[model samples]
Target chain A: MTLRKRIIACLDVTDGRVVKGTRFVDLVDAGDPVELAARYADEGADEITILDIGATRDARPALLDLIGRAATALDVPLSVGGGVRSIADAAAFLDAGADKVAVNSAALRDPTLVELLADRLGSQSVVVAIDAARSAPRVWRVRAVAATEETGREAVAWAREAVERGAGELLVTSIDRDGTRSGYDLELTAAIAASVRVPVVASGGAGSVDHVAEVLEAGAAAALLASTLHFDILRIGSLKRALADRGLSVRLPRPAPSAQQVAAWLG
Target chain B: MIAVVDFGSGNTRSVLRALAAVGAEACLVTSPAGIRAAERLVLPGVGAAPSAVEELMARGLWEPVRRWGADGRPLLGLCLGAQLLLDGSDEGDTPGLGLIAGRCRAFPSVADGGPRQVPHIGWNEVRTDSGAFDAYFVHGYWLDADPAAVTGWTDVDGFRFPSLVRSGSMTGTQFHPEKSGPTGRALLSAFAAGALDARVEAATWS
Candidate 1:
């Protein structure tokens, strides 16, 4: 009856298309957000995060059509973020079939927004996403506006504050390791996870299944992956199997066939 | 027809979709009349207990829902909906419908001084008398129910609490079966079918 560590597939979308970048810049197309999300769900992703990376900068709302499509195609919970500045915006995403609404810059601007969303939509549906970069050795500062502005607030401190303000979960992304594929900033993740009593989802560097396992072992309740999953560098099924083999509890659709086993079957 | 109660809390679309996936004709019902008219009832909620109670009262659904339970109609509550069936909750000093004999309490801090998070959000294994299966959970409070009413239990950070409870025609689950993949779908399908058949048998006998 123990809680299983989750593997969350993140889809950073712009203009309704999935995109990926290094350090949150140099955006490149990944694929259709809905298709990728459905595929990940089928492959046993515990949850899916569809972040509308362009919403705030473009002064527009999240792609409701795309979110609705993704929701219809998958059974697992869908958490949508980006451009959620007001209750109405969050409502729009939830109405569009998102199970949870993630707020980042807006939450940094006014922490009460977290409480407001939690008040109206239930705390379980409110996730506060904090993008942080190492400010000093072992010190991480919160970044905003797409990791362009350093808010001067320490990451762990902000995480504690956000949860107190009614954030049910914290999506902590390490800006330094993000897209670098160097693996998650375990120190930062563990620190934030320890500081707060809410579940923490570790985002930003995921290079391999070992990295996913490492983060979960370090204290992350869940791990979010982008580049490796988007580019087919690793399959969700295999990663889950690898984690299970490592004795970390992970939910896989079924036992994934090994390459050698597939070869034998084909022969 | 299965009616998923909506009182301005939680997502009913996913619950509806999950029920549909299980071949149940589920729809959202937001009024007292709607609750009374449905063949079966599902109270699905995920917000603060006080607010949820306020909305149900405001919509004049408070009495109807209680009556439905009193009449021995098939009723299933999920998450906050399950919590609402209790006498009250510590989350909001809110008085619930009192359909089930329990009060919701916050999860205690980790005993070992290790970091055990509140709002235990993730997939957790649920142990029912039948067997074990995984379900999605996202809550800070766990129900303190009468042991006689408990049907299932889940362990979190060494804390054992009621994850499922049943009384008469009422059943409640602390986890979101709609979000638990195939296992969830099967549970929902079985619940709907069993409830419907029970209703049919009651009708025939009466």
Candidate 2:
């Protein structure tokens, strides 16, 4: 069977609570991160990515607790990101049950951090999250600190470097399209996807099923959804079905097995 | 109790939680003594094969684990653990347990399907004779074993490889069942029930 394109549900958590806002401002409480993560898994999310947007030295304990609870509730892979700076910080998240840790600002500040993370935690456990804003019609520049600062690094060049430094996957988010409900910055996503040999997960600006389908068609291996999923704007089950209808290889949710069926499988 | 072997690496907690979710009485077995006390063993690992083997040896579990498999008790190897059940691996030029007759090979950078990623990461379908179930997988190398020993297969990039394999009472899966949702839970429950062991016994009798 062909590899199924993944659908990742992202939770932007702050102060131990799930929150979302337009363009990283005017935050509003969505619900408990733990409950929402479990619900998404039940809805057939291939993976769950939790970004501690409010990640601080003081908030480390709360974030780890939240991640541990979410990880226990999930059967699928759990990826944690945001404010992960040092090897110790990443190790703490992994110990807290995060299957993977995503690095952004710290990675850009010190590219060797990716190598260190890969050496310690395996490359598969290291994800390089790149937030890019359109600088020209065909050019995208990397932005850091939740898209608050420009890094002057070309997005595609950084993507290649990250992969060379041992990033197993790239989480590319489009700052220009973020919270716009327009669609993913296909040009930016496709560029990064084409440049990197690893899997590219397109994030930001997922308003409709077609938008997601468009990104996948653009060569992304996965699509990360936040507002679209958190606010009930779109449902994962039906979205997967729609993608399947479109002939994209997607993992459809399976029925919960009964005790008898489990026995028979073993037999 | 089923002992989930822990060698200071790997996602042992997730394995424990998955076993608990499936109602399996399981615990982390870090030493030979713990392995001796358990009725069955589950070797779950991630990361590089050499490091895992090193950690297993460092923890004094190498000989005991190999002896356990040689004795033909139920053994389930997950991901890197499954790779370790083979004779050797291309990763780090590492030597494996040799419980199965094969070697772990890395995926080609370019195949008939054109350029593909090294670490095949994501959810993919594991096709068994009975049916197919999508399981989460993350690995850079795959097991190349005798086809008769292969029970389940998965396609990645441009190649088809063993996702699940069996040899007598031992079983191994390239995919992570602990993270594969319902399908994984069912497999764990079956292991706990000793249903897989029964199959091997029946085959031998037949």
Candidate 3:
């Protein structure tokens, strides 16, 4: 069985605007989320993610309009999340042409909502988003939404339970490793890889292409990124070729990104 | 029309737009039948293990997605979507699709207190040991498994993680491209165009 690997493009949005940066401290305007997403699709992004970072401070109702434009603009899959409060909100994203809606704070508020959503949409539609922190050694806890200001919860344990309850996948982000460029927390990643039965994509702390290889080697089925690609320092075609050469079983191109396209991208 | 599962996770709109912008015929699908009939499948997600998987289940696409990945019928998982391909996650003690042989864990050195913030966000160089171009990253939990499974990698604070991976019929990433400028655009294009041939062809036929 030959599987084609996918490259996912994520856009962290705030107040209907696309933002780019390293630490989430100093961010620059990338462009309109919809326009940029469409451009990347034209360039060859396998999928797209629209993250509403602003959803934390204020519910971004404008996302509906943005979603409509973005959905109408691309032919690939698109998923949206951030401040998604209820099943109705999830439905709203789909109505706007989103393929999925990620509920974070809401899910934290009601863990059983995963089961509720699973019953309504199925097991694959409900995604539990945990933005957690390390309170102590080997102890990761849900950082917000009632589980707040405490460190008694074990993140790994919750992951297993979520699957049992009815979650199809997991997206784990290390608030510490995020935007650090120091490299991913491999030790933590390994631990998660060892425990979970589902595919795990490593996130946070990447500076070079080798990091991608490192996470994959660590057993992550996928690598989620942000900074490097924004810098125009790495190209996916080259990375694919490099992976293919390493005998890691990558999605090889009959004719990868033309030298021109790659060069243009680098520029 | 192809199905793009939506339940409240991932950068689904951008993925859809990328497809349409590139002139690929696609749709954001939510029903079991719609997903089952999709010529090709694109699974995108974000957030915690429990929640991400929870949403996938809520959408009633667990069976369909699992079947697609298992069948090797041109399936792609991006960012958290890619992570879901793993067996489990430490973020929320959640299990994933199990398409790949690995688990997701929390970041280390968080207790150490210097720069071990959760949700590793931002753009950094992605120089891979494979001698390929570098990429970017943004998240907290990382992947840990066998060294042989890596496709691409990047460095940050002296640590490294796989930016890309491929295990049989599945592939995934831990980055956001809809935000990455031109380099991201090129990569996304390659994914929709050059990087994948089987899926594109199958999608066309379907």
Candidate 4:
């Protein structure tokens, strides 16, 4: 009866296809972005995050089309990120059926964008994505521009500022562990979660059910999965059941009615 | 036609989309005249209570919407729209439409010695008398009212609140039926099919 912790499927779409890579390179085709999104939604993903890794200016139309198609198929919340630099950019995604827009590099460049987006679209629709990497001993720093540049800002501090600027949720991605299958950065996620009042979605390094459960124990309101799900290493229903068996609340799909029952009901 | 009130809120598109998916013929109505013209009305809103109320007032939809519900016409409120049907809200100390005798209150930031985030996002179950169904939710404020007013209840970190309510011809759901997949679709389809209307009529005559 409690609020279920979210299991979000991340679709790192590049050049109109879903791709997964280790630490944001050596990209390999996962599936068609829209098809994978629809499949994950059917598999009971609580939410879906579509990050257009190839979101150049010219790629906007294709990304929008993909998002529109995916949104049409999804019944759960869908969040889109990558190249969202302005209010108009966020609006475009919403118009294309995205429930929330995740902004990382743009919000770091100008935090006011978060405020603007919150003002126009409500704070609940704004998701500030923080890509963090280990910079020094026991320190994680925020990275921008698809995790290619360092902002010199501490991850926890940036998270607080993002919330203050009106980000309803934080999508904290561990660049060091993304696709590494080691596990989420527990220390980094817990730090950010403790520093902010908004919900934090822990992303990257989800290789097993325990990894996912561990991050949630560290205080992430949601766990974002990509490669494990895209490559069919894990199923959403079984993962949810495992999480539930550990006493964590999750939305389990209802059993479908039998064909005979369906016939009787239709009659 | 069913008029989906559009006050420039973010959820209008989703509401319209869901209604269309349910095969409900709906249109975005902003003016009071449009509100009056519709056979049925849907008030779908997001954001703060004050601003949402202001948007309704700005479009002259505030009074007409109140009257539409008062006339026992079929009306559906979604999320913030549902909150606005109450007398007032703790969010911004805002006044509501006074159609329902209740208030909107914020969810506790801390419950059971653990931090509970505001703006409870994602999917949760809405338990009715018949059964429980998973539905999507995203809000910090919840309706504080008599249990008799509630048709469905949901729990968030030990804080139980009304998730679905019905008063006369008007129905309100705290969860987003438009985004809640099949369960939500069934609710919307039931609403479109005059399921609530039939019950309201039965009560009125009885």
State every prediction's TM-score relative to the real structure. Answer: 0.88, 0.95, 0.54, 0.90
Measured against the true two-chain complex, the DockQ scores of the candidates, in the order shown, are 0.25, 0.57, 0.06, 0.32
lDDT of 1 by residue, A1-267 (tens): 368989999999988789999999998999999899989988989999999988854435348878877887777899999989999999988988898999999989998899999888878889999999997898999989999987889998899999999998899999999898889999999999889877799999999887899999999989999989999988999999999999998876743233333222112
Best by DockQ: 2
| Model 2 complex DockQ against the native | 0.57
Estimate every model's Cα lDDT from 0 to 1: 0.84, 0.89, 0.63, 0.86
The residue-by-residue lDDT of candidate 4 on A1-267, one tens digit each, is 567888999999989988999998999999888788878887888898999988799999999999888887777789999999999999999999999999989999999999999988888899999999988766899989989998999998899999999999999999999999899999999988988878899999999999999999899989999999988888998999999999888888664333333222212
Error of 1 at A170 (Å): 2.0
Model 4 stretches astray by more than 4 angstroms: A255-267, B108-115, B200-206
> Higher-DockQ candidate among 3 and 4?
4
Q: Which residue pairs in candidate 2 have backbone atoms (N, alpha carbon, C) closer than 3 angstroms, thus clashing?
A: none
Of the pair 1 and 2, which is ahead by DockQ?
2
lDDT per residue as tens, model 2, B95-114: 98999989999876574552
Superposed Cα deviation of residue B108, candidate 2 (Å): 2.8
**Candidate 3 local lDDT, B34-149, one digit each (tens):** 88788767787655668877777887888788878888766667778877777888877887788877887776673544233234543445444434442334466777644565
| Interface RMSD for each predicted structure | 11.1, 2.2, 11.9, 5.8
lDDT (10s digit) by residue, model 1, range B1-206: 99999887755777887888778898889888899789889988876788889999999999999989878788888999999888989987889788888899887767753227677778887776655667788887888988787877888777889888887767888998788876666667766775322334555775
